[model samples]
Target: MNTLPIRPEIPWLAPLAGYSDLPFRMLCRAHGAGVTNTEMVSAKGLCYFNRGTSSLLNTHPEDAPLVVQLFGADPDSYHQAMDKTLEMGFRFFDLNAGCPVRKVTKSGSGSRLLENPDRLYAIAEIMVNKAGPGAVGVKTRLGWEKGVDTFLDVAKRLEDIGVAWLTLHPRYGKQLFSGQADWSRLAEVKQAVSIPIVGSGDLYTAEAGVRCLRETGIDAVMFARGAMFDPAIFERFHALMRGEESPPRDGEHLARIVRMHIQYTREFDGSDRSFRKLRSFIPRYAKGLRDIRSLRNELISCETWEALESAASRIREMQPADPLGFDPADVIPD
Candidate 1:
């Protein structure tokens, strides 16, 4: 029998596109994210040798136990992509069957796979065979559309094929990120599968994460937008789970996170593109600050790394207010 590489009790970072880069993963890991995933990579792109895909795979030795998530509609593409990642020394992998973005859905990948359970199972079977038992997992949604309870069947089939774990965000693909994630469906999936079941969706706070773990009896929690708003969510989740008194979010702590993100981004990829990306990200990281609008404006206006660094440093000197952080804006495009 194969076991998951990660401990079920600690929080894992979700495979966020555009946001969960190498630097961001390191930031979360530094703050206590037990396992971090690469941004969803294109299996087809890997086989085609797409230059952009290479950047998504960048990692440091410290970013260990990373899961390289791959999305594609073809088993052949998955076969080749897994080969490349295994050769690259990635020990863990995930099938991205949960993304509901229009681009991914239109390609017959992502949550679109939920519509064709046979095809999804075929692809998952190939991944497990190629990667070996306990090396592969699948992330998915409740179903392709509302009124469809497609998750339970899909979860059972994937488990039968020996995929190591399942990360479920309980909402229809068509629903995207709208409305509430029906966590009741999580209990149903958990009862259906014998393997580890990791719960996702609406886990935007440490309290919610702890509540979900207790209420649903799932194996672990994977933080998405919650971790985005505050990378320390992983640490906070653990603290709350253990009944330990966690520290409140403060300027000094937030400042450290910003500084570390900047240093890691510079160390990994400091080109103008990376700099501009960091400029956009700092405001999100600062959502818990007392004056988000003013801070947001300042960050958006920054033209140089020096100016941005100056603004971020000022955060350390100010006292903070939001208990955890601003609820991450729902407007995030995933």
Candidate 2:
């Protein structure tokens, strides 16, 4: 069987909703992410050529080891979408069966798929058949609810269907990242399946990712919220894997990250909407930093690229006391 372009040491970037765009993926890749995924695309949307769906397929030549994630309730449309992506040169695919948003679940996709284990397995089989063996993966939660954990059964079935790998978020659909990500469940899934398992959830730092691998014995980890808060988490993860000290995340270093992301955003998209989104995103990078709240307030009013660049400069020069605690990942409507 063909193995994924990932290992226990090389981390995968999660298919972040509204965030993991081509430019963002490229930025994370530059920092050391081994694999990156496109945000989840609706199969029906792609089949019908929805307005923004095509943009999600945008890629750069350097965006290798990339996976395109798809979500939908219709099997035929899902197959068609997968075929479309495969013909367009994408080699790896992931099913988004873990999103808890009502928008996704109401359509019988996302975590709703978890409630139908048999159907989930059947759809995964179709993915494997369409994408080819060792080229398709499934990403799902532990179950639809806390006490109804079905991941063990689901993982076994997916592996039997020849899925290249499995990425588990280790939380139920309704749990919605409310509590801790049970790393113990990851260990259970790893021992239950012969195929590779990539653990997700609650991995907010390089230390957390490394600790997950050591404790769970899983094949690898995929960083979602962690990467959003700190794209350099991948580089730090690599350092820890090599038994070397991770780079310092001083204010200037973080300022550099802010600058690079801004440059990449301008290079890829300099639209007003893009800048607005960046305004919101940059504050996440400042997570745990003192005197950053006021900077965040200032960013909210930055309407021009020049203005945003100037604010980033201030971020570099100002000496904040220290980083405060990271606010947990917010629950956004997906």
Best candidate according to lDDT:
1
* CA shift of 228, model 2, Å: 0.7
Clashes of 2: 2
**Against the hidden reference, what TM-scores do the models get?**
0.95, 0.95
**Candidate 2: tens digits of C-alpha lDDT, residues 196-238:** 8899998888989999999989999999888898899999999
TM-score of 2: 0.95
Off by over 4 Å in 2: 1-3, 329-334
lDDT of each: 0.86, 0.85
Global lDDT for candidate 2? 0.85
Q: Show where candidate 1 strays beyond 4 Å.
A: 1-3, 319-325, 331-334
Candidate 1 lDDT, 56-173, residue by residue in tens: 9999889977899999998788888888988998888899999999999998999999998888898898888888978899999999999887898888888889998999999999
Give all candidate RMSDs, comma-separated: 1.9, 1.9
